[model samples]
Target: SVPGPASKSIITGAINFPFPTLRLTLAQENLSQFHDLDDWGFQQELEENYGRVVKLTGFSGYIDRHLFVFDPVALHHILVKDQDVYEEMPKFLCLDLLVFGEESSLPWGTIIANIAKTMMPAFSTLNLRGVVPLFYEVAERLDFNSISCRTSLELIGRTGIGYSFDPMLPGQEQTDRYARALRGLFVTAFKLQLFIPLLPILMNYCPRRCMAQEGGKLDGSEEGKDIMSLLVKGNATADAGMHLADDELVACLSMILFAATDTTSSSMNRMIHLLALNPEVQHKLREEVLTAPEHLDYDKIDALPYLDGFVREILRLYPPVPVMFREAMSDITLPLSTPIIGSDGTIMHTIAVPKGTSIYVGLAAANHDKSIWGEDALEFKPDRWTKGKADSVETKLPGIYGNTMTFLGGGRSCIGFKFAQLEMKVVVCVLLRSFSFSKPDSGIRWRKTGIMPSPYVNDEPKLPIVVERLRA
Candidate 1:
């Protein structure tokens, strides 16, 4: 059996106590610590005390034991080599169905894969280059107070679906019903986390309530330049078997909007925050952007070495979605890069995971693993990418981008990663070129809200940065 902290209650397992109770067990403390937003210390402790792979007791003593895995070889197997076996949990799919819509007869994975394939050209370098000016247009008018959410929504709206959520004018408020609902979805989802099992029952009462209101009208006909338009066009031409149903198309609209907005915005906000903290690094990056040609197309922006390194380092260190969950569909033997001793003191190379076993893919932990990324893994050093140090890092971990699990890996990996990268770089370049950012008076705390964490100041979702315009 895998080694793990003992559970206090066999029925509750390692479930965290809501009320403060005296004489808590180690298992309770471990589980409680797991919920912390800044989990770096907890991750390190897990690695030290329990190795890269720790068995966590959840809900039930033995039946509900979950594996918290950050082991490189195990991660590769779970994320890439044998991803099909470690599929999304049913409850999660139920949550998706609740948010998106009814799943078609086709497997959810197949649907996502098809949609991702159809949308590839839309996010291609040549295509995204045309939208650089739009990104800058939004970035230039950004207010640091609510910059991430509103700006990201407007950018995605204009470039992603040929819509405009906000006009970016000073003192203007977003009045679009769809945009309001879309922005609220994350908070709604976060509140509904505990009720995931009841999502199926709730679907019967409020079937696609959120998406059905506005998403159905987004038929990809507006201007015909956005990704939604391309998807609709592609689906029109695809063979009968490959054709997406009406609901599926609608789901895609909401999915793209919801997924793209929060993650991209969170990352952008974090980048700005990091820049404010390290003025020297920010100045250096700004210099790189400034020294480049006045007009920066996709190629020119991408060619900036320091800018690329800065983006890469931020994504590596602070992946918007820090963790992802999966469940085993069948009995499988999971491989590990290093052998670990079992609870019985036996050195084990491979572990047998039965069907229905829960698995937690520790993305942030893997990115910060000192063994793979060297001793200074915890430091925010963008130069590692430019200094030949990145090459020394282990390559066994499977990630879609920058040798980190920020975007995950395998068929279900983030399809719009390229689009996101382009969006982030373009916005960063535009913002840095026009303005200088400094830390605010109050400390910023990144709280895990929904799928992505957001910056909070004094318990409110705001990043109050001191911004000074450098040029008119």
Candidate 2:
């Protein structure tokens, strides 16, 4: 058996599955460290203390053991080579079905394949280049505080679906119900973590409908530019065998809208905060963006080396979703890139995992691994890429973006990653050139809420930064 920390309680395992009151009390005291595995220091401790493949006790005592793995070779096998054997956990699918509907499950079926094919054109460089001005238009109106969330939502709405959630004009309130709902969805889901097992049952009793408005009939002749419109157009022309049903189309829309927003906003928030903290890095990046041609297209924006490195470094160190979960479909042995000494003092190269065992893919841990990224892995250094440090790291790990696990890998990897990158680059470039950001008066702390983490000040979910308009 894989070695890990012993459970303090037979009932709760390694986790503190306390009652609501007790949990609240612990949280109030800031002593609920064990409750959140996504804590950066805790993640590092797991890798440093127990090695890459630490067995963790899950709910329901010894019978429920989970493997917290970040081994590069093991990650390759799980996320790429043998993905079918390590499918998304059932609870995750159930949650998606409850939140977005049954058709939201995009990991399987020819419908997904068709959807990916249809949406490819919309995410292409040519298409994104057309949307760069819109990105700048939104960014120009944004102030440092309370803008990332709304800015990202509006950007996706305009570029992804030809809609506008907010005009983003000064002093205008975001009153779109759908946009507000999308913003609060993850936070609402995070509060319901304890009730995930009952989601399917609750969904049966009270079915949740997709919030996306029904797409009007589309003929192939309609030259709509947005992603959803393109999908609708494609579906209209598709053969009978490949046509997507109405529910499926709605599900796809909701899933795309939801998937594209929060993670991108979180990443953008991290970038801004990091830039504020590192003024020199910010100044250097600003210079790179300022020196570039006034007309910044997708190619020009993507070509900026310092901007690219800055984004990569932020994603590498502080991934929006730090950990992802998968479940073993059958008993299997996982190969490790580096052998670890077992509890019995014997070096083990592979681990035997049973069917139904849960696995936590340690994304942040892998990114911070000293062996792969050298001893300075924990430091925030974008120059690593420009200095050729990324060359060696790229060949060792199987990541879809930047050779880091920020966007994951293989078939189930983020489909709109390119779209996201373009959005971040365009927004950051526009913001950095127009304004300067400095740390806020209050101390900022990042707290993990469900799958994604957000910055907070004095227990409120907020990122306060001092912003000054730059002289033209």
**For every model shown, what is its TM-score relative to the native structure?**
0.89, 0.89
lDDT of 1 at 421: 80
Which window of ten consecutive residues has the lowest lDDT sum in model 2?
205-214
lDDT of 1 by residue, 1-472 (tens): 7887666677667665533353256445456567655554765677668878898877667667588898888999998889888888876786677545555676666666777666666677777777887787777777353667888888888777767788978777888776676676657765556665454333332224533433444464334556766666767778887777666666667667867887888898899899999999999998998888766887888888888888889999999888898999999999989999999999999999999998989899899888888888889999899632375885567887877888898878888887788888888887887889899889888876667888888778888889998965
RMSD of each: 3.8, 3.9
What is the lDDT, from 0 to 100, of the residue 123 in candidate 2? 68
**Which pairs of residues collide in model 1?**
none
CA lDDT of each prediction against the hidden true structure = 0.77, 0.74
Candidate 2 global lDDT: 0.74
| Candidate 1 global CA lDDT score | 0.77
Q: How many backbone clashes does candidate 2 have?
A: 0
Task: Give candidate 2 regions above 4 Å deviation.
Answer: 16-19, 22-34, 37-39, 103-118, 143-145, 193-217, 220-222, 239-242, 387-391
In angstroms, the error of model 2 at 370 is: 1.0
